[model samples]
Structure formats: C-alpha cells, structure tokens
Target: MTAASPRIPSPLLLGVGLMLVAFNLRPALTTVGPLLAAIRMGTGLGTTGAAVLTMLPVLFLGIASVLGPRVSRWIGPDRGILLASAVVAAGLSLRALGGLVPLFAGACVAALGIGLAGVLIPGLVKREFPGQAGLMTGLYTMTLCLGAAAGAGLTVPLQDLFGGSWALALAAWALPAVLGTLAWAPFARPSRAPVAARSEVTRPVVWRSPLAWQVTGFMGLQSSLAYIMFGWVPLILHDRGLSAVDAGFVAALMSVGQAPAALLVPTFAARLRDQRGAALAIIGLTLATYLLVVFGPLWLVVPATLGHGFGLGGCFGLGLTIIVLRVRDAAGAAALSAMAQGVGYTIASLGPLGFGLAHEIGGGWVLPSTLFCALSLGAAAFSLGAGRNRQV
Candidate 1:
C-alpha cells in the first residue's frame, strides 16, 4: 500500500502551528537590540547609521504590509504566509554571515516576511477561528512576546558562548525561523472554501471608514512605544552605566511582563462594552512607568520595567483585538488588518529612528526621554477615540 498522506489538519495542530509561527515573528527583530552596541562598534556605524539600521526593517515592514492584500490575492493566505516564512528564514540566515551590507539587507528581507505575516495572521484567525478571535489572538500575541523576550535576553549569552561573535549569535535565531517554516508548510496549502465571503465592492470601504482610521491610530500609537522600548531600552540602560548583560536582563524583565498581558488582555477586552477605560488606564500607567525610567532611582528599575511591559502587552494585544472586533466578516477583517498595520507601522517606524536622532543631537537620553513623554501623552489622546465601541 502507498504511504499515507500527511495527517489531516486538526484544531490542535493548527493551534500549534500558529504558536510556532508567532514565536518566530520577533526574534529577527529583537535580536538586534541586545547586539546593537556590538553592531555599531563592529560595523563602525555612527548613531545615524545605527538608526537607519534599526529603521530599515520597520520601514520595510510598513511597505510590505501595504501590499499584503495584493499578495494575499496573488498567492492566497496559505501560500503567502509560507512565502513570508521562507523570506524570514533566508533573511536571518543571510544576516548571520557578517558585514554591514548583509546585516541591513538580511533585516530588510526578514521584515518583509514579518510584514506579510503580521497582516495575514489576524485575518487567518478571523477566518479560521471565527468564534474565538479573542483567545487565538491572545495565544498568538503571547507567543510573540515570549519569543521577543527570549531573543533579547539570550543574544548576549549566545554571543559569549560562541566566543563573543555577535554574528554567530544573530545567526542562531534563524533556526527557529527554519523550524517555523517547516511546522507551517503543510498547513499553508490553500483551502477550497473561502472564509466569510462578501460581494465585491467598488471602493475600498476600510479606507473611508472613520472607525478604521481610529483603529489604525490606536495601532500606530501603541506600536510606536513598543518599538522604541524594543529598539532602545537596552541601549538606554547601557548609557545609564549598566553593562550590556545587565541591560539585557532588565529589558528582558520588561518583556517578561508582556507575556501574561498578551495572554489575558485581549480575551478580557473582548468582553467589555467599550475598551476605552481599560485602554486609557494602561496608557496612563505606561506614562508613569516612563517617568520612572526617566527620573526615578536605579533601585526602581525592576518595577518600572514590569509596569512598562505590562502596559505594552495589553495595549498592543488590544489594538489587534480591536481590528477583529470592529469588523463584521473575514473580508472586512483582512482589509482592516492590512490598513491598520500598513499605515500604523509606517507611522510607528519613526519612533526608533526619531528617538535615535534625538539622542544623537542632544547627546544624552534626557531629551529623548522628554520626547517620549510627549509621545505617551499623544498616544493616550488617540486611544480615547480608538477605544470607543463602534463597528467599522
């Protein structure tokens, strides 16, 4: 008898695949932070060049996300994601080989893959697990946070383990990408039945919807803060006299807080009438955390890290959850997701680059910290409107 075909997909299998993919999404990005100082010194990149290095991937993410819908149409969700995972694997592997050009190029490639996956994964959840968007998104986001924390916390040790070769350490993350691609390949084949099919529309409904824009605003604002923390917190701590390893540990502490919030907040928010109160509270707490980071004594760093992380985890998960809740069908969800992330990431890309420039110009973290305060207040303002209970 012929060998049996691969086992048919089951919910448990799909869930595992989703978690694996989610786990892979952030390593390529987060690994850079722990190694930022090494990268700058090794490559002779000044602050501006370093900023560009950090910004390029996020910029590519924005640009790629904008094309997500078209790509989805071309390859279908299953193949599109498979292609993205392949890109991530190739990028991470290439980046590990050494040299500034390879480093930037590899990051851009991985970001492109991440961009496509970032847009499509939510739509996939909306379509496949229609009744469980909250739980799935929570699981997916929590895994994302866990992956990020692992990358940030481990890269330095990995570098040391490899005899202080940052290149090898960066390359190590590629393994998970390869594994994720393998885990996802079987499930990436297109399904026959389309999800939540709707009639063709003449205009882009999501673009014109106020609610869509508000959701996009929330996404952009929250992401701006998250990326800043990811891109600079280690460096910031290092500047404040902490050693690289210690800085990484502190950053990891912040990241650790994200996992629980990412796991729980979306599910909780889904049950609320208007998520405004919760959203505002999180933002307010985040602002307070920033203040502590900026001016509080070193002894307070642990709590500050935890508070900031919890805020980011809840805020980010809730932003994605809003996209799912604000729409009616999978089609709308896809459109909304693409728009929010496309425009949102495009806006958020500036945070790291801009803050990097601020530090360079001011020659210290104080000016940048002030700017972050303004950004925190602004994000809070936008969250007010975005958190309203209105469907797009």
Candidate 2:
C-alpha cells in the first residue's frame, strides 16, 4: 500500500495562523521608539546607547535570519515559528523587568525570533499560496504593518494605563506573542511519518547570482528606510515641537497608512510586465513625502506622514514580492528568502544607527535627512534591476 499523505490544516486556519505569527514580528521593535525617552531616563541611557538599543533587534534580525533555513530544515517551519513566538514572548517579558541589561538582552532575543519568522514566512506563503502569491503577500505585509502601527500608537496609552511605567507598557506586547504561540500550536504538531528530502543539487545557490544581489540590495535599502521610520520618526516629530503622545500618534498614522498600500501595491505590481516603474514611483513618493514631513510647512505634516507611510509600505511589500517573483520554485524561494533577508537586514541595520549618529554629531536633522535621501536614491537604483521580469 502507498504511504498516506500527511494531513494539512484548512486554508483558513493556515492563513489565520500565518497572520497571527506575522503580527508578533514587529511590536518588539516598534514599541521601543515611542518609549525610548522614558526608558532612557529610567536606565540612564544616552543618545548613543539609545541608538544601540534600537539597532540591536535589527542587527540580530539579520543574524538569526542567516540561521533560519537551517533551523527550519531541522525542526520544520511550523515548529520553528512556534518556538520563535515563544522566544519573543519570553524576551518581551524579560525586557519588562526594568534594567539596561535585561532591556538589551530581551531586545536581542526578541529580534532573533522575529528574524526567523521573517525568513520562513515568505517561503511558506509561496509554497502554500502559489496561485495567490501576490494577494497573500499583500495581506501578509499589511498585517505586519498593522502590528507596527499598533505598537507605535498604543504604547504611550499603555504607559498611561500602567501609571507611567514604560516597562509595563513595553511588556504589554508580550501578550500577542503568547497568543500567537497558542494559536499556532495545533498546526505545529509533528508529522506522524518522516518526510523525504529533495536532492541538494536542485537547490539554487542564490548567493552567487547577480539578480539575487539586486533583490537583496533593494530589500536592504528599502528596509533601512522602514527601520528609520520605526526607530526615529516619533523622536523626530517630538523635536519638531509635537508632544510625545502626538509624535507617537503621527508615527502610528504613518504605519497605519502602510496597511492599504501594503495590501494594494504587491497585488498591482505582480500583475504588471515589469515592476520597475512601480518601484521608481514608490521611491519618488517616499523621498518627497519624507522631505515634506521634515522640512515642509507644519500644517502639511499629517498628509505628508500618510504619504510617507504609503510609499514606504509599498516599497516594503514590493521588496517581499520581488523575492517571490524572482524565483520559480518553492525551494528557490526559500533559498533566496534566506539570502535576501539575511544579508539584506544586515545592510539595513546601518540606517537607524547612522541616522542617530548624524543627528548627534550635526545637532540637527539636516545631515540625517541627507543620508535618508541618499539611501532612497540607492534603493531606486537597485529596484531597476530587482523589478525586472526575470527569474533567478
């Protein structure tokens, strides 16, 4: 008798699990920005220290992403994600204990979890929703942005609710991670029979491919912009004369704007013959809106923030979509996902750190703004190659 195929969960269950897991990915990073001032006051952290704290999650994200494929191969993606969620929950809890050591340690642990999920989820989407890659990627990216928005917007209120304890506010995000772990548990049950593996010869070595490098460059550059928003935009707004609450709300608005664009951009881009125009348009919008937020009339800030969010969200979604588009098979997607996110996020970690240093050294936002514009141009250049209609 032929061996029975392993049972699979219903599509609805799988989709819900995937999104819930995605929701756990960003709060660990976003919550820190709005709470940075309070945390620094409590912990005696200076601007440089704050920048290092902000950069830690992103730096570890790259490190853990490099290990994702190997971990998935050993434990299976579902189980790996389950473990990641649990780690995130634990890290967030640790971060709430109120000290510099715990804070940095927790951030690193949480980032590692986020990174593993980041690398594994794309391959899972490509494997499970092959025909609906664009739609699913859009949905996935939208959920991710919503998570970020929630963290950015709710954190200050949460601090108030906790009677001005930033630690408690930061700790509140752990609940989602715990919930995600439980929600994904059923799907993470090990298979009854061992699965067979494909030959190594068929897997593409994406590290050597120029097309893969182009995609990685786009992912990194665009992500640098996204992380800058996540890490510094609230503080930037505060410096422009907004209250902490107002600054956080504006940052959250930017993240909220990302939702619709994240949902639409990839779906639209996937339908086009080449995504180069879409890529260039997104970069242009990003640059213009960001400049307006920083230097244009104060009255224009809200609309400009929204436009910035939309552009960055589209840029991020397109970056993820390009990973799927550039490869032909699920295995190829997994391999390329690992390479792009691994090296790409490593490159991305520099942006927030550089921005912070520039702000401190120059005593203004102008230097940082220049750096941001330069990164946008670099991303635009790489997008030209990454958005081409060719598979690696």
Clashes of each: 0, 0
Q: Could you estimate the TM-score for every candidate?
A: 0.95, 0.96
Instruction: In angstroms, give how far residue 375 of model 1 lies from its true place.
Output: 2.1
Best by TM-score: 2
How many clashes show up in model 2?
A: 0
Report the lDDT tens digits of candidate 2 across residue range 1-392.
99766688898899999899888888898999998878878778998888787777888999988998887788877788888889889999987787888889999999999988888788778767999999999999999999999999999999999999988898889999999889988888553432225423123568778889999999999999999889999888988998989999999999998999999999999999999999999999999999999999999999999999999999999999999999886667777888888889999999899999998898899999999999999999999999999888
Per-residue error at 331 for model 2, in Å? 1.2
Q: lDDT by residue for model 1 over 1-392, one digit each (tens)?
A: 98555455798898898898888888888888888999888888899988777778888888888888888788777778888888888898987679988898999999999999999888888877899999999999999899889988998999999998888898888899999999999898764455535623112878888778888888987888888888888998887788999888888887888888997999999889888888888888887887787578988988998888988888889898988888877767778888999999988888888988999999988888877877777777777777888777
lDDT for predicted candidate 1 compared with the true structure = 0.85
Error of 1 at 386 (Å): 1.9
The best candidate by lDDT is 2
What TM-score does model 2 achieve against the real structure? 0.96
